[model samples]
Target: MSTKTKVPKQPLSEQLSVGIPDAGMFEDIPKIRRVAGDSAGPRMKGKVVIVTGANSLQGIGRASAHQYAHNGAKAVFICDYSDNHLETHKRELNSLYPDVDIHPRQFDASNEAAVKAVCEEAIQKYGRLDVYFANAGIATGAVFTDIDSAEFMTMMRVNVLSVFLGAKYAAKAMLLTSPSKPHPSGSIIGTASVAGLRSNAGSTPYSASKAAVVSLMQTISYQLAGTGIRANAICPGVIETGMTSLMYEAARARGTEKKIGQLNPLKRGAVADEVARVALFLGSEESSYVNGQAWAVCGGLSAGHPFVPGRLS
Candidate 1:
């Protein structure tokens, strides 16, 4: 609701031109022919992927599942703690991609047994687990000193431990099953946040839990090396998801809405799809050599200080 506009230090086009080659030079090259927009690349074709926390209407999990299905994944297993909402998301996805297989299951990501059972169920139904996005997370707003022990434990169990259980079970399933003769084996992606990278005022428990996700990803990547299972974390900035929406609303209620998106160099917030694309890239073979990395899809918000209008010359 706050209309404060913070201009970025540099524009996207300028940044893109600096790093990438001119497309005109490759326009006439036979190897550079552009595929039709409607075509599904073989990158994820026939693969089975599981995504957690996909039931939320404005979360990255839903967006990632849709992208995976659109990219020709054979089956997309959606797991969430909410049965009714999960069914709704499953119905929507199935309606959108009638030919694609969409499997919806009710399970709590924080529960180790539930996580393991879901992984096994997906493998039994789909034959193999190719991609797993451990995206289920919870956020709580509390000052570091005043935070209750129980609240801290809940955040850790849901945000950090859930990722650990997901990676453990998903990797176990992937190791037991062999990959397609030509395609690579498997990938595990965890969703961290900018909070994990930097301190967040009044969000100590949430930030600490997200930080744990980064550590979990690094440890999992190292442990899964040589097993054809790559692990990575997607560190998204303030996207306009259900969780952030609540935060924004709370800020508005407290007359502090102007602080939203203030830390990002990019003045505006990102949509869920922006983060989902990075998840897809990490889950696909295009990033075959990319492992143990935290890909930040933050619209350059994390690049530098935001240029406030009156504060700057």
Candidate 2:
């Protein structure tokens, strides 16, 4: 069955509308924000970026794609293997931002040939590649004993292998940036999960795959030592994307929607664009020194166990 059949209409336009400036800039300061200005301008202006798993209207990839364009990317390539709304999303972004180029394609990020072709096409069409975000992943819930082997393996390919393949091609492409540059520079990011950082938070296969992605980024960072390409991962908490809509629906149906993220310190889940902003930061020059780490955007869910001081055994 297609995942699209299970998906509901999304608020992508509304999310993007409020998050990134429609035609302005975003400043990166110590929590001190700014409006459009020379000092605080589009972070991705003139850069070519690609975001995989962008078909879902409300997924992190979609939000990142719009944010990238809103910030002035010369070209943004996005794709998804299952999203039925691929063309619709591409057209929407183009219609909203006439100056920014948005190319939406359909392909499986886990396939080697497909991944290579996407990278090649981006370079051929856009002239160069500056950032690659391997954000395609799936989550499944099942007891360890009940999970099938094939399901586990597929999760690994979707989450872990996709990251590897994207990084492999992104690093090679970033090396071709203007030779005059003193050092290599490009970003390779993947979406991990707070579940990957700890146990008992997510199902077996999903957690394993996400954990591998975190490790993959750390190892890739070392592999691309002098290439100027940085590797990192984003571990998000519960966000109501299509991937987790089933979970959200269950909570809503049970009159427990308000408790969805109550386990975290902030006591609220994040929006897709919130995670996209972090992606924007990692891809921009502001994160020049950030690399090889899994940054959690989970409202402090993974900070520590919620042990009350006097209640401890």
Candidate 3:
């Protein structure tokens, strides 16, 4: 067995009661070891948060929603459109973190009225919205010639438009929060793709939409300057999620699943939890200085396609 150190798991109730993860707890978390050693855990601590597109079992939004609750968020509004398991999931989350107030809602995320309503509900319930994770997105699996204007627009609405709406309403709610509150000006996180970062492989419409999402975050961050509210995006590389399940299925059929992320230096793909970890950081106080930045979480794949440097296996 590997001799790696293990941090004793915090009892769910105590984690909920403690509210904030302290700087002293940083050494315990393996994934959150800030290189500077000034890192901490449970940075959220009593904040009311929202995570969109939390419908899928393998999605980043779902992972992030639970992380917020696990870290002692005062409330977590988990949302998606018409998932049969939403209620069951809600019960599970409540049982796991009884101290948290978990609310599950179903609505069309791209719809402006619906987006505004959810933010309004959260503010009314928790008195403020600290984090809004606009992670709902769709992959347009078609080339330019095969895609129509309607399909293109749908992708944009789901991917780019959703972020715009979340930023608008979430910022409004955060600004209303009392300045005396710990995080009066809050964080807004969007799930962008590495395909948006550069001309890598992906659908044409999907690429364009994600590129717009990245640009949207950069532009909005500037718009909210000095307001204490910040906006940022995460550009994730190959990960095994509902969006990319087809790729994994095909590879597994041929027994080539191990080679899914061979192009990256790590030589393996990631899971929903990996990207969710980044979301947790962006949503927490630890990222107070981080704003208007598009971060790449692709295991160095964004650096360049890995090429063998004369050492053939």
User: What are the lDDT scores of the predictions, listed in order?
Assistant: 0.79, 0.83, 0.83
- lDDT tens digits by residue: candidate 1, 1-313: 9885543232122113343333455466634433112234556788789999998888899999999998888999888887667778878888888878998888889999899988898778776888999999988776778888988899999898999999988987776644352222578999998778766422888888888898889877777655667899999987888888877778889998667777666655778999998888888877766788877787676566556668766
lDDT of 2: 0.83
Put down candidate 2 lDDT per residue, 65-157, tens digits, no spaces. 998999898899888997688889988989988898888878889998988988888778765788999999988888889987888898889
Query: What TM-score should be assigned to candidate 3?
Result: 0.84
Give the clashing residue pairs of candidate 1, or none.
265-301
Q: Which 10-residue window of candidate 3 scores lowest in summed lDDT?
A: 8-17
What are the runs in model 2 whose C-alpha is more than 4 Å off? 1-39, 179-183, 307-313
How much is 15 displaced in model 3, in angstroms?
28
Off by over 4 Å in 1: 1-42, 178-184, 247-262, 305-313
Ranking by TM-score: 3, 2, 1
> What is the alpha-carbon lDDT of model 3 when measured against the actual structure?
0.83
* TM-score of every candidate: 0.81, 0.84, 0.84
